[model samples]
Target: MKKIFIGMAILSAGLFTSCSDFLTEEPKQEQSNELTFATFDGVNKAAAAMYGMFQSDAWYDGEFTLMSELRCGNAKNPTSVPGSGRYRSDTQWIYSDRSTSPLWSYAYYTIARANNVINNLDDKVGVDATQQQVNNVKAEALFIRALCYFDLVITYCQPYNYNATEDDKMGVPLVLVTENGKPARDSKENVYNQIVADLLQAESIMADDYVRAGVTDKAATPTKPAIQALLSRVYLYMNKWQEAADYATKVINNKKYELAPADAYAAMFSAATAPEGGEIIFEVYGSDKNEYWDNSGWAHLPYITTTDDKGSHGDVCATKDLYDLYSEGDIRKSMYKQHGNDYFPTKYSGKPKDSDPKYTNVPILRLSEMYLNRAEAIINGASIQGVTAESDLRKIATVRGASQTAAATKQGVFDERRRELAFEGHIAADYARCNKSMTRKDFDDSKNKDVAFPSYMWALPIPNRECTANPNVAQNPGY
Candidate 1:
């Protein structure tokens, strides 16, 4: 867990390269950290760079999202042998020390960048920035760090409630500061506690209405509601049912967001920008104008999920197991389009005019998810006055033109979640946290069609490079 420093040359090329409308200015490259953090302008540029890191292909921009769906029954490779040779390993649940996800390295890289911002904020806060302005930046940094850690823990460690002794299980290293040291893995309990601490402290200092300046897609930046939404999800993972329901209720009660109507459901994701007053609470902003656009070009999710028509890759396809869950009248059922014999999800189908599949924003959180989270929480012994689990579940079902007959039951809620959140990337994590084995009935590969619960494969291996470099960091049990 030693800090991975971004070389000045690499930082100049990647960090300063602005995503259109998200960042307004690019600061001159300075050779030293002092010059970079010396002024409020410099600090602001650094914060923008931290935000830009989310667009990396290893993280939200593509693989992480696609892998989540592919590993679960929600998605599959269209052919037993991948035609494009993309997502084959993931769809087949193949993992080795050398073939693990790059997310471990990329997530830690982003965390190190966030640590730089958090560590320097107090000393650098001067006449250039007000106290409140500095606090907002710090809050944003904390939120980003928490998010990265949460992803790392879920991917590299077993679920919080995996067993009676799960709390003592090894989690990823907790690197809260920018320093040179090989840190060992922290316990699962300690890692989750750190995530909660970071999020709660961020919530205390950030303004409810504060949006980062110069960001065209406001949901890309962390807001009060965004923090709450994440907390709801995190609590649900931790099995803190009451807390999960309460936090979800906070976001659901907010007037800033509303569920997109059934007619506009598909359009909401395919739009260039998030629709105003739409369901998206947080998303990774994608744009053709983004200069650091390496991930969005050909290897983007839109290309992977689309048909070969219009030069797209068409590698990932929706499983019949998932497709059959949607009833005939449900608007969500229309989110898929058939090609040959395979069904591809249209959630990441790029903007209408785009010749290539790029510039499609990726939704990380939405209002519909809040409804799902609360419903799951309520079904597991949490209570809300005048709001049964059925009522919360119906909120989503009604808007999407689906039947609510399956509401109020745990399995029903889980099935509804798969239908509502498919391809947006919650499937694998949902199954793992709930201690349910994945059953991919439509997959062509017989050997991996069923992944048993509590298997070591659920926790992906640490990247080989990290294990080689950091002696103190341990790989997960399977690898």
Candidate 2:
């Protein structure tokens, strides 16, 4: 998955100066995809390039994800000393800066790449054995596009429940074509509709027998399971409880993955390779050797890198709130490392003394989430036999070496999710959709963290650059 620009050819032309009969090669730049998607092998490489976009600093590796964790309140800037300016705005909850929302441009950039591959697939005349190639490639690209748009909208727009009359709220621009267009902000419903449509269309076209290639260590590439898994997440955000549960079940029931047992849990965190355990439903690979942009491991990295091992460590510390949630001897609590008084997550770092590249894979979705999603849905209203909120609670508790909670309640589910998915990027979002505020206004004792709505403080503002350049763009209220 790390092979940069694996096989998407760069088309160029040169004249033969010593020609017996003058010959000039036709330009290929105009028909780049003609050769790029000429066969299954070519299209496969193009798909890899599409997936590679996640490695950029804007998406998984850096700001796009880092900002999400900052607001979770589980991890805060060091207490005694103010840290690096890298994500200063984020930790302080001042999303007024343009850089805080890097996903805005990078996501659209990736979408354009996906469109290039997807738009070209339809006109492949009568090529040999290219139908399956086209189908597989198109499905993957559509999944890529949907994945980006989902991340973008969630960052830029208010939560689905932000406005009772949801039709009036604006979402990030829904760009679908390769050619640039002066697009205006669309309604939230329309943006979500496009996301759902892309994912469903992707699911329908994917080969039933399709097994994602290019990685054996983890689920690096998108497949039917990944697509279904994300649909579950998108539905959850949309507040479609039943649909979320159903789609989650589709991924959970598939025999391809399983949860990493309690005994192997420690190894799962500091895994030298992309993990092979059942828990990793989907992930993005990073380098222990090269610090590529969007390396996927750095989202949890500390602000400073002055440790014994060159690990990105100790800049951000887990909050007392998150630590208190773990009673005792819970495997999930041990995921964080303590430094004097501050505690930081070790899931993305190496052991304190041991030296390694510190590059870790980012788990985009996991089996545990399926159970949680279903449990929440059932607890809310939708009922599914053979599983209850309590059952799901016990399932995760057993794996984490924690006492099994017999009764399920709204708060119980929220607490369990915080314990299970902390620092993995859901902390803030879970609170937002539930209309909950940060556990403490200022974890670092700074008086600036405010979680009030009309402020759009929780929801990021449209980047200043975009608002300036695009006339049709409308900034969020507070900004």
Candidate 3:
């Protein structure tokens, strides 16, 4: 299907929130469900509500992305002179409940909405709607649901390869319905399989034959490339290197997206509107005054609020090690501005106010990821179809100016990924998928050290609120 970008329209519909042990879907208002599935416009409005979950303080627009890098040692909090322990727990992986980490409930909250749409859409139809239209609506919900589960599993479960046979291990429960059922954790293997099933079905239903005749929003909707791109990441996590490479190759060969050139790379982030075609396959849009994290917005994150801030109140700085990864002439290197010990990247500086939303169009998938995924997969023993791992690495590195003298290697792929994806999330999961341990021993700040592989800390504890409410819900071991 030729993909069309249906820009995400914000809805006034009330969103669902979970209060039970396991996730239970409830509409934001009474009769909301009845109206939601009553007409096609209503179902789409529900879809917009799912996007609201994406705009939340805990999920993509904020902490979920922050947690990925913070716990992985890409960011830090100031050394409190005393009393004020701002980001201590986060940087130390000290999160426990939904209070500190809102991702748990919000993820399930998103999944619940998706289930509501998928299960109920059949009974409700818009005027003059075709089966294809209905199927498209359901496919979008499935994609969102699959995305939520993918995020939840990676956040709350240990690395997939933690056990040679991980089918018996626990992940967050696979809640496929909206009812208030108190379910125990499903195996990580099972959750992964479910994600695959959802993504494949989603792919099957999208209008593959629909060709884009006009412009479209890059992140507003899921596309075949987006589904394929996500499957690449999912397979990478599963250690299915061949599958990862294959899916990545599929995206790269589709000819739908061209990587933003080095000069254009920084501009892509700064576009007042979602920019014209580039490498982005999927993203979420939020502004300073609207759908932002805190009043400060997504840009308010990335750095601590500071009076002397250039673009952002620099809270989160790039680790010195991350800052040092860039070589001269690498356009990617210039993205960060080092202010003393703190470095702020201008990628999120779309609206440069002290507290305004950075106008960050949150990137969920990009062409660069596909190249990186393909390279890493090939290096890890996947068969090379059209290009070698090194060739793909050079494709990215050369464009970024990092390959002027840099040679392609397994480590080179890691370096490019870490640099290319910095602050856009994917840091910890990168380590997890590789079965590598993350440590903060190099951090200049006080306290915590290694977040070792195969540990309970790897899986965030099931929220205390849920456990307290539902006897069937089990807390993560050692939390």
Candidate 4:
């Protein structure tokens, strides 16, 4: 039954660019030769596939700019592969023809999935069975779509395109329809408006009850918490600090999720029970038999282990800066182990007891992050208070073994975020907020051995495909 669901789910969800004039047609199965998405299960399965894209090689497998491009900080080493190492130019303060790079396709591929879900969902059938269920499903789809758009805008377009006369700022293609036809880019401000609209509607629709956070039941969908969490993150990126603080506070005060204990910190990254950890508000589970290990294998493992395990791609190591960041008594240092001069990040450490290698589910949102974000937002946007903001956030991380204290300043909050959320894809965003830059020496500990922030890398260049195919699309200045 699970296999059937996985298979139908992949077929029903769209994950490629729609750049031709192909007409929309219902997905047909070989056995029945009939459209298969009229049922609720069919639609649900399709949505699962779209959510699954977050874990694929396109985004998390070290291919996505989240780690590869030197847009944020230095990589641990110059030991990067072909498609992933283009950001080295940024370290040298050079920008060339990266506008035509291949990484852009990942953005479009994700957008295609969002388009498929938005296009195929029909209210007529869904409303007949359960209006609430239908709305919940639609809300989940919209949230996913919004996430894709948000990623594209931050990655490809300039930061808010603040000065452009509406027409000059190139936004991503807003392909709301599933038809295979190219669409021109929207303005940056226009794209922001759409993103805000999607999140607002999604929160309203998801206000009711639903299941998320590792619940694999066919009926499960994103709930209000997930929507709110993403909203807080979006607002933070947009510099809407008050709004970000409000949403972050909302989730923090809800009192539903709690941070794991100090002992459970290691378990939070353990493959065995990570999905069950109360902190994980959204995550993707993986199985050895399936292709969806969330790229934990590719992102965390190093090439040529001391044991000489050639199983995983020979890449990814924790830099000495990250290693030295841990204090002498901090228990968090256990999360990584030294295999010599190089330290291997243990967030996805292989399983114990000689079983098949396993990695924890990729965590998308967690309550601990909410605490840090609320603290940052409060300090950035509102009046500074010790107990309410700084003390409150520090209390949690302290109990959870984070060695840092909360300070109500940009540097303090920034450092807290870096140490606490390290490698969870939050540091790159921080670079944008502080407007900092980094160097190749930072990338490999052998050179800089210290961390520096590069502000320009915060807004990633729009994927190469959009600029090449759409004449209206513009590339980021330095790329």
Candidate 5:
């Protein structure tokens, strides 16, 4: 594994009084691991830091989200709008070991932090914390580690079903504990099995309504539903159709969440605080107060999707290919605003304040995805009583004011997923896992417009730094 090195600075208890403050605060200096994980407060701070680390540009705040869209057909760089020239290589499918995303290092850094908490939770549970409290902490760490591994495996390895025999295919390294020893990549199936095991363990420990204390934004933390929702996605990727459908049903049946209605759909994305109890299962909290916020600057998603006149980067725009997918009365069409000849997504249209673009929350998982996941699974031969692919798809289509035409078929479910989850970072994986080739008609580069299924380019190259540091780590094919 890549060297797991991070300063062990436990913030003062006063620093994490609430979610906003907890997410915004940065650790000052290195402390000993013994002191950092000695108390419940200390362990809580460590878990909070794990959530905060996701705001880095390499992860949710920028590249991880935008690159997925850019590489797929949903996003484009408009010639009319001025940009920072970011994501151009991704849009054109131009990648190399050096040019590949920095998500690898960032994810490992987060996993290491989570490992620190998970490894120490049991031993430290006595005076300052109860067993239940320690369990919650461990659950959070497990969820974070599983999420990071899922992202790494999907990015650095082919789809779970890429080959008939999975033993030959390698996934990213599985570093369950914080250690410095270099490790070779595990098989894709082993990596997925580990993810499922972690999530299931987390789900068992956490209460159905367990929300982390001090979190003002419930979506920032992992609740039981959130874990189940992620399991649904993971199962879908693993081609466990029945399991995927069942897990999606678990999330969908949870009355705590409901899909955002048509009128509130666009606003959900732009809310300064993540919207509570409507569609959002998990989101990356964005705030000017966040330590990484200022550094993100023009590279942020809000800036990239907004207009130049709005005092943002105004680079990424919605292609006609995606825009045309919505019917005449579909409310999702309103999420895009045209400037000259370009149509920019208003999904990240900034928050309510003057510094709007800087503090916009990014949704990571939502209830709409559960419906889509279930719908896709059912269409692909999953069984759920009283549920047809059409009915589940209509659950989303009705809210978006879209008519359900051909939602009973696999192609229709895929189209609905693209329509519902566009630019949220599902497109590339959806295409790859479903074995569908991407043909971008609206893209300018004709030579590189289409990405065929089963291509080696589906898996990104492992970082050169990782390869240099760990001779055991092998680069992905066709780097």
Candidate 6:
């Protein structure tokens, strides 16, 4: 499927919080100035732009991992760049330093884009677009906004306070409407409420018509499945285990998405050739033409390399502990390459020399995650022993025909998730939801093996620029 650009209608300014300048470039006088959200095509383009924000390193490659490390108790040393570069070798990363962090800023950038869509969508001047198109666009925008807020809250603010009222807790900023002026941070409860409202609205709007097998569907955008997947994640974070399990089960059995075969896990990551694997429900697809190596998945993930077809940059190898989690006879073990006694994932290796490295779109949500989630939620909600009660947990585990049977214990499922979903941006969040202790010692002994957690993970201080722009905002705890 040919990729579509959303903000093509909006002028591409460097950065702006204004609704008018959100996605569209300034309209050329030659074209009619009266374009409105009346058609599927126009609205679809705007929806497409939301995904672009994810492709940018500002959101995914850089800020995304930085936030994960914060919660996971992994940080680099003060002498090194705090959050940039391949964290392949032994480099100390400090979590306290404000200089090297871009998370808060990048999150706002995404929020601004989402705000632009929400604000301008209802005002579309054209009538050709139906109420359904407008609703779809709005729902998608809401979904994006909720996702960004959830991302910000988990990293910058404290975890969800189920006991507090929406206005009392300290949550991240909630920019529902686009603003030309500065805005203050909203309470954490307010942010959560807004996220829930947005997701509910998205689920309703999406209904059943928004199914897309891959990135090919021209009308591709979040569907009921995507919204449910996110809600499952949100509820899990909020400690609503039964709700999380229920939502996750809905997706797992929905027939809209499915888990990929364990044997195909290696090939599912190939950028050029991997068929849209069954595991993916939604993703931010990127193209070599539109993206560069530093920002591309092919360039950043270490396992996909040239010489070994399993190693790249000879760095960022999977942790020995993580590697060992897989048992003998587990076919997924083949996904990693252990050349020269070092283990690297084979998932993202670039094609052989000179050939354009295929860049598979990163999976934002997948069936495997939903399965793991169901297991966790069920275990958290009502722990039961044996096959009948532990059925959900067992279904996800024992894949690859390994000796490690499905675990009835919390540790078993948790360990299974770490191995099954390694490096896909789930580890830290999973740990947080589970309320596991995140300390420097854990990373040093595990993933990083030799690295210590920098104080920065407590929360990267809000950027100076943001504080200067909006004085009401306060820095996170210990930052």
Residue-by-residue lDDT tens digits, candidate 6, 1-479: 11112222342232221212222342222222134233444444544555555645545543465345333433222221122344433323345434545556556665656665666666553555666666777777888888888888776654573223333257766666553445567777778778888898888876466542234422224777888999988887787777777788778777655566567656555544324436667665544433322433444443222224322344344555566778887776777666554565655464323444344355577787887777777777633233232566556555555666667678878777767766566666565445455444324433433322222243445676666666776665555
Q: Cα-based RMSD of the predictions, in order? A: 2.4, 7.3, 6.6, 7.1, 2.9, 6.8
Better of 1 and 6 by TM-score: 1
**Steric clash pairs (candidate 5):** 1-182, 1-183
How big is the positional error of residue 283 in model 3, measured in Å on the Cα after superposition? 0.3
TM-score of each: 0.94, 0.85, 0.86, 0.78, 0.94, 0.78
lDDT: the better of candidates 3 and 4: 3
Better of 2 and 6 by TM-score: 2
Candidate 1 per-residue lDDT, tens place, 331-358, comes to 9988888876788888888776745646
Off by over 4 Å in 6: 1-43, 66-85, 88-93, 97-101, 123-126, 161-169, 211-220, 271-277, 291-299, 302-311, 350-358, 382-389, 439-456
Give the Å error, residue 65, model 5.
Answer: 1.3
**Where is model 2 poorest over a 10-residue stretch in terms of lDDT?**
13-22
Please state the error at residue 374 of candidate 4 in Å: 0.9
Q: What TM-score would you give candidate 5 relative to the actual structure?
A: 0.94
Per-residue lDDT of candidate 2, residues 1-479 (tens digit)? 00112122222111101111111221122335456656555444454545444544456655565667677666666654444445554666766746557777767766766776676677663565367667777888898888888887777777777775443388877767654455778888888888899899988888865755544343666778888988998998888989988998888788877777778786765564445547777676544322233333444343232122454545566777778788687887777666656666767664333544344556678888988888888788767767778887788888778865625877788888888887677866788777776546337545556565434666677878777777778877666
Q: Best-fitting candidate, measured by lDDT?
A: 1
Q: Name the best candidate (by TM-score).
A: 1
lDDT of each: 0.80, 0.66, 0.68, 0.54, 0.79, 0.56
